[model samples]
Target: MSVFAVEYVYAADTEEGRDTHRAAHREWLKGFVNEGRLLASGPYADGSGALLLFTAGSEAALLEELKQDPFNMQNFVSGLRVTEWKPVTGAFADYA
Candidate 1:
């Protein structure tokens, strides 16, 4: 599997929708966490977006999985970016 950095850009005026779906979103993420696919995830301090770290077989596979996210399904995300990363050191160095 490869490590991927997934970026989620929140759409403006969607705070209420995001709040309503937060539980479902976290539940969906828990499934991945249990499977060891999701390493870490959280919203930005500024609340403009979120960052998620995951391990997947490929970018295609990761995107496919992300398509099911409640945030995506609810259209709370204005943009999504997925980047394959090479973690050369620190907590994720082993992934490299």
Candidate 2:
């Protein structure tokens, strides 16, 4: 399996827009974490964006998972960036 960093940059306008879909969004994220696809996730203090760490078998797999986010489906993100990362030594070193 591989490890990846998936960032969901929320649109400030979308944050307000997200109020319409917050419940579904939370439910979707909970499912992903339970499934081991999401290693970590949280919002920026400014409430304008969020970061998501993913541990997937491949980049394609990660994209497939991101497609499942309710917020993404609702176009609540300003942008989404996915990057491959190598964890050399740390609590997450075993991730890759």
Number of the predicted model whose lDDT against the real structure is largest: 1
Question: Residue-wise lDDT of candidate 1 within 39-68, one digit each (tens)?
Answer: 899999999999999999999989999999
Q: Per-prediction count of colliding residue pairs? A: 0, 0
Clashing pairs in 1: none
Model 2 superposed RMSD (Cα)? 1.6
Model 2 residue 54 CA deviation in Å: 0.9
lDDT of each: 0.95, 0.81
Which candidate should be chosen as best, given TM-score against the real structure? 1
Runs off by more than 4 Å, candidate 2? none
Model 2 residue pairs with clashes:
none
Summing lDDT over every window of 10 consecutive residues in candidate 1, give the lowest-scoring window: 87-96
